[model samples]
Target chain A: PSASAEAEARAHQTQLTKPAGSLGRLESLAVAFAGFQGCVKPTLERIVIRVFAADHGIAAQGTSAYPQEVTAQMLANFCHGGAAVSVLAGLLDADFRAVNLGCVGKVAPHKNLIDNTIASATADFSSAPAMTAERLSAALNAGFAQAQQGDLFIGGEMGIGNTTSAAALLAALFHLAPEAITGKGTGIDEATLARKTQLIGKALKLHRDQLTNPAAILQRLGGFEIAALVGAYIGSAQQGVPVLVDGFISTAAAAIAVALQPTLAPWLLYAHLSNESGHKLALNKLNAQPILALDMRLGEGSGAALAAGVVRQALALHNTMATFADAGVSHAD
Target chain B: PSASAEAEARAHQTQLTKPAGSLGRLESLAVAFAGFQGCVKPTLERIVIRVFAADHGIAAQGTSAYPQEVTAQMLANFCHGGAAVSVLAGLLDADFRAVNLGCVGKVAPHKNLIDNTIASATADFSSAPAMTAERLSAALNAGFAQAQQGDLFIGGEMGIGNTTSAAALLAALFHLAPEAITGKGTGIDEATLARKTQLIGKALKLHRDQLTNPAAILQRLGGFEIAALVGAYIGSAQQGVPVLVDGFISTAAAAIAVALQPTLAPWLLYAHLSNESGHKLALNKLNAQPILALDMRLGEGSGAALAAGVVRQALALHNTMATFADAGVSHAD
Candidate 1:
């Protein structure tokens, strides 16, 4: 982020026809964009959303309500442009891509699908580590390579029982109990939620020592798509493209990515606070205030996709609004 | 809101790719719109935003940071399409109108400007009732008249020191101390906020008995634009058009409107939670959950205008997104 561009944007905001700080978060959002883009007039004309699809081995433990096949099925839906994120991408005219980091079954090829499979599925963390270090690095590189040029980047995930993995990851990193950060994913009943919590507790205990290191944490407890999203966040920041972090799983990935590189924090904008019970706690740990809070718990970058319009408007207002002098309006005393 | 249309929308939601409650607030918002429009597929193609501009005589008590002249100045800014709300309305392609409920100085008229001036300015509420019963009724009628044909209605206000009046109204209605509901408006310093709080306390004491009645409360402590907005909310509901209420003053108006006719609550959608201190209390009193919480305090319907995009996308997704059967996707168990 360019300090000079941010300063210029702040000066320009004061000239806009409103009281200083009256626009509040919108003003800060535009200024942040200016800094991120290193231009006084930043525009969100091009948004690239990458939905990383994988299957979590934890699903075998009855941690999620849906079958693991749903992961590959949803990936197919993304390819067919029949998913919520697909519709939202069209609404924002954003470039949407489905990156198959890993899936248990074969995923049919599509023009918009990027096949970068590291493994068919992760190992169930309740019994063992999710992935090897080599596989984790491969997943990270795949996401880093897919971080193409765009005005903004959004990373979403799709994996059955991935919330279990995310909860374990957050519990390990934040050193909190599994029950404190466990939530029902895909609308599970009370029994399933309780079982999921127990499984996460076991996983956290299994990876307790390894949790001290970020790379070890990802290798031991994170799914392929989770690692990919972490890499995507870091890669987007490296490429000077800001990333809009999605819901719980994505935010968990962000916590790992930012832990590895604190500088990436400035490049990340939380899109929404999910309805998932753990989301607020995870977001608080990352010191993020998301743009929307519609209690949306759906993953697949849908929340981030919805927020794209708000970011676009912030840019539009920043670039197009006439100054007080231009409008002949009186300045605040 | 039509129950049959809402039921159809809910059934369609279950047929979508995600879980029944996965989309959370988005699902409820879409269902609410479907019910409001009395159709399974509701569209937000036409949005009408009315920004009521009026001067507050309370500015004479040093209750605000800006001079009262800013009320008329911002009205011109809105007419010139240079204000925050104006830029946001243009971004959303919503029809924007600046209704001059009352301004101290002459405002050059435009086609979009509604000349409904009931008074040059309201009396200083710190000393006396802001408006006569007759003037209050006229202001309400003007707002009611502007609630014409549109898929969605947004009511915003631009009145200097009106927060004082809003706080006084809320304090009188809720039987709370003025300090609890008063906040810094338009970036006031500590001293100014203290002074504003004291003035509101005085006004509340003077209007204690009249505040028991909603109409009397408006006449005693509301600005012309506030009364007009209260009327607009009621009129829009009476006309079967859902209204999106904006910020502190707008919420105050909504409180009065809902108090007068509790049925109007179903016809209102809160746009955003403002940074003002009393806004949350007012919204809680009405049992309303706003769509956005950007800490925005810039009146003129800017928050509502920004939220227009979100509502439009919700409508678009509800109408266009393919169902699980249509898209050949499997549903959850």
Candidate 2:
């Protein structure tokens, strides 16, 4: 956050394992942090995967075909590292951690529960609902502290009907119409699309008064998880650690992070392009092209995890390959 | 070829740099030569790129407008190892020695002469003009002796208006109409195509009496190089070494080899698909898929050299990467 820290991040970038320009965009990410840390081989000693999960009260509206139980089931899977992101972090040799930033029903504190309760899901953020300013700041701090142990961190999200909440937030914050951004989150039929659209329309009008910049928008209409992702990115960047950004809902969190601290944008790696309509918009806003394009639409950081292979290959090519001169052969000279 | 020598060839493939079935096709190739020399690592001691060149006496007939000198110049480049095939063989650590099997005018021999003129070129084969039996047998003997030192061999071609010869070969050999197999050889225009088609029609009529099987086909109408490739394939198979088949023209040689000795099919590794239309037809007839598809159209064993990379990677993946059980990772079952 300080000018000195920003300068430190830039200095570290020049000292990474490969040449200055070879790794392409990956170089940009490592350098942004290196300048902050001011060291070569700035070890990514830990890789905390921050999962912000919550229950959406909008499930009562029947907007999602999936039962709300899937969210908590996935959250439990996250805790056990049985989810796709868990497998990915293990492959990348990064640390795996989760947080129940906010959830509904009778909740018990699980291991590594970074931040708990802010009351379920904020009344759907569609009717008379939004998080208070105090609750929002607390969520942000909880995720930040958890990520501080890692050299870099990856942010993941899980929640049924979270897409509905994200759509509302995007509309209220960016002042975009629902149709331009709204897309089928998970096999929504035409009838469900109309229903979701109308719901977003209503949520935007109610939250319009509270809508300001990203910080105010999150405090009013954001979830406990959204605020935490913003904090995770900032915390990771502040410590000179890069963050692997996942899809759609994670992109929404990324947009919020960027809006809050425009400087944190350099620390982010756009893992993969999702088939989700909002993901393209978010990627376009961020100006990122993902590595793989298998037409995947799943969102538990699976795309990001797949991209780890591409990034690893990029690093290997940059570092291991002998140049034409090194091989003592003329390279089409 | 003695019965015992042939039996020895049948007994084993050659020993490669790695384990059996490790490099898959490549491993099979490296070992198949064991029968050739009756040794484990059947060394390719007698290396010769049977560069069967001819002036497509049809060129003198004005079927091709380019001066016959272009073919000689290209042949010079091939022998100098400055062409693409030379660079590729260098990558694979292969010895690419050339033989001037045939070409227009006189090719004076210094030291590296394998076989010289087998007639300036086959008569256009359009007016009872084809190779005499004595000349065809001499070319075959030269190819066999040149390849006999070790079973492994590669054939390259550089003959202006040779595509016309190839089309006639394909038509007579496969019993097809000229239009069914004709293509833009050496980037000829439509007017040239019309003249070429008519020229082929005349060759078909003239060679109609010699449209027998593979041997008669060679003696009656095929060029010195095509005959040499046929001899080379059979010669290698007889010696018990695997042969790396190049492109369409070579594929034609392979088809003729198959027609001669059916067992030779297993010894052939179809390297890469060529952009030549005839190559696709030939590959389809042979029931093969090439290893790579970089849109190669030249015929100098370039495709085979490139396919070596795929073979190496496949071998590495099969032999090096730790399996799920080996790594102590849980399997899906």
Candidate 3:
């Protein structure tokens, strides 16, 4: 009965103002939205982006390819309209909002911040994760309510050492060992990579029970930002708007949303495959195929945002191109 | 003087109703039009596609990646709109015209044939090339005069086992060994690659004198279609219409065009970087950067034609996008 809603969405998708299936992936996305909303002509109006950002205790472990400060720096850049996502969101005509779900001690609210502090990142998972379940849910609810107006919502994450957390969480969820999921996050080398993998292995043992519960798994190993993204994902589907799943970390959150409510998978459109090895696992878990395959690893919803541009073109082309019948070009081979 | 004319034509690429430089490669192409005519606001009207098609004598050598008949069959597909490029050009509003500069005996002309039946293809260089220098030049001249009214010209080629011909020609021209220039055309495997490289080595020895002149090069190892593309490139430059260079074979022709008159190089814009290894070498020789890098191996100007869409987007974006001041958005951080 639940699958029927997405199916209804799909039927409406083929009936859009274009030749059948002409827009390619965009047609699929429109169909996905139809399924999510259970509508024939799903609206994608009032687009909103809920960007969840946090700090990772794993940064103390020196796990990231970039310095931990970059997470805070980029978040500020997003607020100041100087980031790639800021420029791209302008290109996409999407409303861009960033929430400091958790960061190092609550800083003053910036222009993009729709939600205040959840905590300054998770506790260094090497000891114990920094957050409790209540904080994660509060942050999630705040971001979700802010996204209520949009018929399409996109969620992104900004956290130092988040990939380490994402890889650890994916390894546990998929029942694979760490190395299989870990990758050069922000471009680390052999020695640092080995340690990063080991740290995740150690964290799993410390938080086994919490890791079993999908929400608990997020709190146990995911960044506050990642957990908020999961909440946003779940909330968007509950609101009947299509939600675009960004790169690997966002996918990690998405996988949690799907696990909690299996029907949520129908609402998500994967933007692009990442250079992250864990992303392939996430895609496999969600049964999703992304549009672009360029080896992009940068996050900040850039993949999803860029992919939106392609999808917009696809829809326009699908809707605008004259069919053989209308063009009067003889169809005779 | 010829170089200046081509450069000026390139500079005048169409205004496309977008900001100048907003669409990058497309803007460059619009500029190519100005460079072509040495004027402003160049039109992309009256497109001419000089498809230099030739059957390689090497098809008999059984050293190609794909079967020889695939070439002739593919050419038939091109005329019938079953080939990808045929669909692409139609999609992009570019008028497509294929030429049969050379092919095997008794090859019939098809609907898209702009120039038909120049020769049945070059003779195997391993034996003696099929045509003399005078014959190659005559066929090339025929193609040059085929499309007199076109505002732009792009060269494409179809030849079974033609990569072997290309490698042999390149090897001879640069005085490099055959292996340095050979590639898996149409997907030949490792052992076959070795045999093909060995065969090219033998042909180079026999065709050494052919390197002395461009016509002699065509007579010795280059395909009849390639020679036609060379002439078409020159003719497009002469007529002040930009020339679009397709994959390896077309670039080979462009190489000959540039060698004959260095100024003709300015009249060309690379459409795609084909899956062939020799393509990069040719691009390096011309010092050109392709617009798209989608791992496209299906040649027939599919890459170039698809790139036409991107170029169009670039032009539209350039001409249409509101500058920061116009959009009322802050340009500074």
Candidate 4:
């Protein structure tokens, strides 16, 4: 990020026709974009969204509302432009694709679906580590490759029991109890939620020693898609592209990525506060303020896609609105 | 609104590829538009933005940060495509215009500027009624005339001390003290805000008996732009067009419009929660849930224009997204 460019943009905002600071967070967002783009006026014309789909062995423990096969089904849906993110990507004219990291069910090939499978599914974390170190490395490399392009990057995840993995990851990283961070995955009832929490609690205890570091915690409790998301976030920021982080599971990835590389924090913008109960607590841990709060919890980059429109509007107003001198309007006395 | 269409849309949302209620407010927003358009799927293609510029009588009390001449200056800015709303409307491709209800300074003729002058300005409400019944009626009719076209209507106000007028009207209608509803207008200092609050308190006491109904309170304390907003809101709903109400001033107008005709509430959607302290209280009194809360306090329908993009996205998803059967995806089990 360019500090000088951010300073220049902030100074320029005061001269706009409207009252200074009246545009609120939008003014700050424009300034931040300017810094990221290293220009006074930044544009987000080319947006890229990559939805990583895999299966979590945690689903075998009955931690998800949907069957594990839904992951592969959603991948096909994404490729066919039927998923939430797919529809949004079409409307936004975004460069979008689905990466099949690994799923329990077979996914058919399509132009928009990228094959980057490491395993059919991760091992169930309740009884064992989710992935071997080599599998984790391959997944991270796959995600990192996707972050090579686009003006803005949005990383979305699809794994049936990913929320359980994310909750366990956050609980260990934040040093919180499982009950505090665990939430219903898709739409689990009270009994399932409690069971999910208990399962995560047991997994945390089983992997307490191995959870000493971010990557170790991720290997022990994170799903393949989540680790990929973490890799993508780091790569996007390294390439000087801002990443718009999605909901609960995606935020968990961001948390790990930022923890691993603190400098990467500046390049990630949270999209929205999700319907998941732990999302707020997770966001607070990172001191991140999301763009919208429509109570959305769909995990296919939809929230981030929705926020892309807002960020575009912010940049448009910044780049096009006339200054006080141009408008011949009086400034505050 | 067609209740049957709304119900149909709600059911249709459940059949889409995502989980039920996963889209949160977007789902309900699409359902609401379905009702308003009287179709299972609705579109928001033609958006209309009308900014009413007038001078407030209470500027005589030094309640605002800018001079009263700014009312006319902003009218020219709006026409020249330099103001915040002008830039937003241009980006949104909205049908945009500025209506000059009444201003202390003379405004030049422009293609996008409509002349509807009722007086040089209203009487100082601190000493007398802001506008007579006849002038109020004329202002409302002028605003009503602007609401005849477009799929959606957005009413914006541009006046130096209209927040003072809005605050006073809200206080009178809600039977609250000025201290409860008064806030800084365009970045007023502590001294100016305190003086503004006390001035409104005295004005309310002076008009205690006459502030009986919504219209009486409006005539006694409202600016011409605010009254026009009220008319535009009512007019838009009457014409079967939905109205996206702007910030504090616009919400105040919506409050009066909804109170006068309770059925008008269904056609109105709150755009954003303003940074102004009184905006939340006013919205709550009207049972409004604004779509965004970016801490924006700029009037002139910028917030509504920003929200139009989100609404359009929602409708697009509703009208085009494939159902579970189409995607061949399984439902939650």
Worst lDDT run of 10 residues, candidate 1 chain B, spans B324-333
Tens digits of per-residue lDDT, candidate 4, B61-133, equal 8888898888999999899988889988987899999999989998999999999999978889999999999
Q: What's the true lDDT of residue A330 in model 3?
A: 27
**What lDDT does each candidate get?**
0.88, 0.61, 0.66, 0.92
Q: Each predicted complex: what DockQ?
A: 0.70, 0.03, 0.06, 0.84
Top model number, DockQ? 4
Q: Pick the candidate with the highest lDDT.
A: 4
Cα lDDT tens digits for candidate 2, B53-132: 65666777665545675555455555554455555555445656556667765554534344556666776667755678
Which parts of model 2 have CA positions greater than 4 angstroms off?
A1-46, A105-115, A149-151, B1-333
lDDT of 1: 0.88
lDDT of 1 by residue, A118-211 (tens): 8889998889999998999999998888787899999999999899999988988888888899999888999989998888888887777778
- Indicate the residue-level lDDT of B260 in model 3: 84
Tell me chain A's TM-score in each of the predictions. 0.98, 0.84, 0.88, 0.99
For candidate 4 chain A, the 10 contiguous residues with the lowest summed lDDT are: A142-151
Candidate 2 TM-score to native: 0.51
Return the TM-score for candidate 1, rounded to 2 decimals: 0.97
What is the C-alpha lDDT profile of model 3 across B264-283, one tens digit per residue?
76668887676677778768
What stretches of model 3 exceed 4 Å from their correct place? A1-47, A105-108, A149-151, B1-333
Where is the poorest 10-residue window by lDDT in model 3 chain A?
A324-333
10 residues in a row with least lDDT, candidate 3 chain B:
B13-22
